[model samples]
Target: MQKFLSNKKLIFELFQFNQNFNFARNIYLNVFNKYQKESSIMKEQIKNFYLLLIILSLIALFLISCDNKNKTGTEGRTLSYYAGNWWGKASGETAEENILTINGDSSITLKIGDEIIIPSTSVTRVSDTNYIASYYNSTVNVSTKFTFNFSSDTQGKLIMEITQGSTSQSSTIDITKK
Candidate 1:
């Protein structure tokens, strides 16, 4: 009976919630319930914020990877113009190094060496800026399709490949300008 006395300060402070109280205990239960619901909603939104950030980050990485296909040149650098030393390595049935030297005369020198034997070294330009150097006595041929790969840059990897329907040999070479 004495505990049922009104709390004047509580009633005044919660004047707006006066009509929204639990009549049995005279508590502003409606206001508390609404506040708790809003807080939980805010927490859920914060959790989704991180999830959205993760999805956006993954999309950005995928775009960057697809944008760059061949990645053997310096950043923001196109292929070199002419005349430089290029090296490359390749792997298929066997692995080997391609040492190439290009001259201003539109000629090229390529050496495929594996220590024990130097199969062959040849230099011949088929057309303008296009050259074909063969080794292994025509057994393995590295067709270098060169045009806009380099201009005057100093560092790069030479792309060399054995001709299709030619043989069962491949090599990839890493090169630097001399």
Candidate 2:
């Protein structure tokens, strides 16, 4: 009878230990599943953040390109638009018919009547629509400055300043592309 009682106590202790181990395993499994769910959610959030960052970066690049286009004045007209023959008449000091020719090579010529006042000279662009050409005539001791401002693709205004010794004269001419 004594031996049987000892065996019964040992069985009870084994049963209790088995139940505690199962409880511990169940707790561990629950915690591991919760951790897996939280880790997946965190990964998705990081992916979405990267996607949003890429989209915003693209928008910023597009805006910068548009701004650069406007700043360079390349929206409506270009330097090639000013390359053509223009005709007009001087309004001050001399009422002479003038022919201003602009070449594709950035060379310009100004003719008063049949005489070439400004021989083919290189033009300097001051702005999107403004240009300048200068000439010094050694025979007449005259220095001439021509400022050309284009109002449109076909029309422009020309201001010519001629300085001889201490005397200076300015003339305004309205020109049209031919």
Candidate 3:
């Protein structure tokens, strides 16, 4: 066994193994350093992507909140053109007892005397120049129709021609903004 172990090849391979080991070690360390740098760069890129997403999300949220606020304000209002107290006299009876109130809920209650002439009812938008209101009246047992043709607005006064079908009374009601 001793004679076999004393081979000349083995004696020469010891120096070869040491050189190969040192060369392999240096190459492996260089590769590891480059890999570490690439991994760090990839990590930074991922962080940047996350940050961009967060910013975009915040911007979207802000716009959505602003839209919601505008909508809520509009929804809370009854009408943009008709809001406030109006007083007008129907045909030949200039007693100054006609009063109409348009509420914020798009409802109108009209009073012509001590009793309520028109109950609170729904009001719908027709167009920029017209608005029609028709209501069921149980007092006289007939459907009463009211039609209005808007002329224009100056300052806060809204001039509209109101026509009541029950008595065929036509009058002008000047609405004021509150």
Candidate 2 vs candidate 3: the TM-score winner is 2
TM-score, structure 3 vs. true: 0.50
Q: Write the residue-wise lDDT of candidate 1 on 1-178 in tens digits.
A: 3333356656665874654554634445667878899899999998899999999999999999889776664333312244666555544425434466655553455554442222213434333333344433344434433222332355554545545455543444455665
**RMSD, every candidate, angstroms:** 15.2, 4.5, 6.4
Residue-wise C-alpha lDDT for candidate 3, range 27-129, written one tens digit per residue: 9999999899999999999999999999999999999888775443434333435656655554466554436765555566666544343433545556654
Decreasing TM-score order of the candidates: 2, 3, 1
Those runs of model 1 whose alpha carbons end farther than 4 Å from true positions after fitting are 1-27, 74-178
Least well predicted 10-residue stretch by lDDT in candidate 3: 154-163
CA lDDT of each candidate? 0.51, 0.78, 0.58
| Candidate with the greatest lDDT versus the true structure | 2
What order do candidates take by lDDT, descending?
Answer: 2, 3, 1
The alpha-carbon deviation from the true structure for residue 43 of candidate 2, after best TM-score superposition, in angstroms, is 4.7
